[model samples]
Target: MPKRLRLTRRFPVAMTNDAYRRLQSFAREAELTQDEALTFLFEHFNSVTNHENLTARLRLFRAELEARKA
Candidate 1:
């Protein structure tokens, strides 16, 4: 039998409208709830992308943080 993964944590999050919209869109397209989508992303994060590409994107996102918040 396969082990079941249970979602038992609850937390508060504040996101920019754009970020929230992106998450909503992703969840909708993937046919998963937002919580499940988030869980899946974090769980598979390591295998999901090229590390160098992710790092580059992270740096670019950091630079855009101020503008994104405005």
Candidate 2:
């Protein structure tokens, strides 16, 4: 049998009804339980592409800030 990995985290977040409904819809479309869908998203957000995008955005913002300072 393949080994399994487990993670535990705790946090409190507030969401609007619209956001909750969208998450439900995504869960259904992806054929995952709501919790599973959220887990998938958490993993996705940590992916290389996402990290690169965030880095690019931060660099852009820093450039703009530096331009203002100069």
lDDT of 1 by residue, 16-63 (tens): 788899999999999999999899898899998799999999999999
lDDT at residue 44 of model 2 (Cα atoms): 73
Predicted structure 2: lDDT: 0.78
* Top candidate when judged by lDDT against the true structure: 1
Model 1: ten consecutive residues of lowest lDDT: 2-11
Estimate TM-scores for all models.
0.79, 0.52
Q: What are the lDDT scores of the predictions, listed in order?
A: 0.92, 0.78
Please write out the lDDT profile of model 2 over residues 1-70, one tens digit for every residue: 9645354765676675887999999999999887777877877776624777889988997889767567
| Model 1 pairs in collision | none
In model 2, which regions exceed 4 Å deviation? 1-7, 46-70
Model 1 reaches what TM-score against the true structure?
0.79
